[model samples]
Target: MPPSLRVSQRRLRPGSRVAIVSPSFGAPGLFPHVHDLAMQRLQSELQLIPVEYSTTRQVGATPRERAADLNAAFSDASIEAIMATIGGDDQITVLPFLDSDMIAKNPKPFFGYSDNTNLLNYLWNLGISSYHGGSTMAHVARPGGLHPLSTSSLCAALFSGGDFELYPVSEFSEDEQNWNDAAWSDPNGPPPSPLQTSAGWHWHQPDRVITGPSWGGNLEILDWNLAANRWIRNNPADYSGCVLLLETSEEMPSAAYVFRTLRNAGERGLLAQFPAVLIARPKASNIEIQPTPEQRMQYRQEQREAILKAFAYYNPDTMIVFDVDFGHTDPQWILPYGGMITVNGPQRQIIAHFG
Candidate 1:
């Protein structure tokens, strides 16, 4: 890791330019209204100007073109930061075309998650820290303005550089909000569905505090990395002392599938490398699935057990916390990928350093 990477971390002043690129699915091209809403909020709330690249709104762009757009954003002297518009299923395909040397030479904060995990991991491997949340369409363009939790956390990551504690939102919604219709564009949209009271963090091996640089991303994406033989370290020992960040996508793979994925990681000697693990709240259901409440509860419980089963078999002494709201959940926190993270088990808390 180069000390120069930290030199790349700069707090953006209001009206500073941020590059908006779609390295994943080009949802922004399909829903221009949604993209416009997000751009408006970035300008009005953050006072930042969004400069869209050619491939940003290009739905059928080749991987090379999107990778070229990313290269352009990182290398540009005027662009202070980079943000993904949304996550897609095939972002893994874009990894090979990225220039690791160029990205490392011109490191800057990158913000995104889900399928954008591919990009986050790519930056992490280059020894550059990035943000693991805040896709423009899903978060910045959220109904009824930005959610308070997401806004506050994102602001801290963008404007300041230090240790920030992460906490549970008092309530979070899994509302059946439709994004394509006019209902989504209305600032005075109908009230969000009732928020479920948080169950709070569930812990295992809550004893010592472990602090280190963070690693890991979406579980499905990590699995893809392993299968593709890309990005993942050849030596498991390379991950020692790092905090692992894991989350599921809306596809909502079955508990058995999640277990199998983790089990494969463990078998590959990956799970034992980290002393702390953060699992995002499993998106128990989606509009396509529309599971019953009882079914949702059972699904989450089973998934939790599956994760615990994997850890127990591999790294039993690790500090594990479940249901973190950073992935596929409402009011997401923007975690700093490859940045310092403190997991205080005895105190039951997690702190991350954006710088």
Candidate 2:
């Protein structure tokens, strides 16, 4: 394996300065209350200073404008790391304007997921590793407080570069509180969305261990990137031995769509490159479509089946673990993008190697 496949040893120390830019969406502009609280936590809890760019709070900022913020952040020597405020749908548009040469010359740890996957893959292709799950507005400014799991994993990713074992959440939530609602601005903030008892992770073909650099994110965004055929390596073999990380966004794509997306990758001979796969707990419900508890279970089961079918057809020997919390789900775990991840099938465990 190439040495650049893993993240560099660079890490943020206490009092480090991090650039908080909205490379995807100017969410801080949309909800200043949520953004402000997140900034406060970034300082008080993490003991890091937050630096915002011009486009950080400018709603409807152009793709070039967003890309410029990212370029500026990466070029700035004082900024130890860069983090996105939130993910949005149009991040793909910003890719064309990014100054890859400038970014490659001055690499910094980036943190975000969902649409941020586009940037993550771009960085990965450049041999720069990033965090796959984080959003200043979503996690740091979470109502009530940050999830213990999120705080721990994020802290590990940011400061401690070591092997970190992932634990399943016994209870989790996928519902979202309306950020536009007045409750978000209240002194107490809005109550946390209810959590459902986790069914625990389900492992398939737990016969061996597979450890390699991580790849893939938000399945939907990956499909878009795959179709663009720009960021992904031209040869599928470039991904051989990598662990696949997949999760669905709040858009809640249907089982058929998920199957088709994976199937597309399979047809391209890309899916077979991964020896192991870690799937995030699917977001079973959204604010618009709240399924009953029973229905939610059914939905998850169907999606699981779709995934198994696709992988079974493409690579029967591949190991799969379902329902690991990350991405759109509550209490997200910050996994390393392009960093080492060990999927131990026999032990039924997942460990992320930070840095």
- What's the count of clashing pairs in each model shown? 1, 0
Clashing pairs for predicted structure model 1, backbone only: 15-47
- In the range 1-355, model 1's lDDT, one tens digit per residue, is 2122242757988978999999988888888888888998899889999999998998988888999999899999999999999999888888788887888789888899999989888887777888899999888987677888888889988887777899977777765566766786575344565577778888888899998888888999988988998888888887888899999988888889999999999998888988999999888767667777788789889999999999999999888999989998787988888888898999999998776
TM-score of 2: 0.97
TM-scores for every candidate against the unseen true structure: 0.96, 0.97
TM-score of 1: 0.96
Residue 170, model 2, lDDT: 92
After superposing candidate 1 on the true structure, give the runs of residues whose Cα lies further than 4 Å from its correct spot.
Answer: 1-7, 188-190
For candidate 2, write residues 1-355 as lDDT tens digits: 3237534467788899999999887888978989998998899889999999999999999999999999899989999989999999989999899998888878788999999999999999888888998789988988888778999999999898799999888988888889888887775468889978988899999889999999899999999998988687868898999999999988899999999999999999898899999999999887799999999889899999999999999999999999998878888999989889999998888999884
Superposition-based RMSD of candidate 1 using all C-alpha atoms, in angstroms: 1.7
Model-by-model lDDT, in order? Answer: 0.85, 0.89
Candidate 2 steric clashes: 0
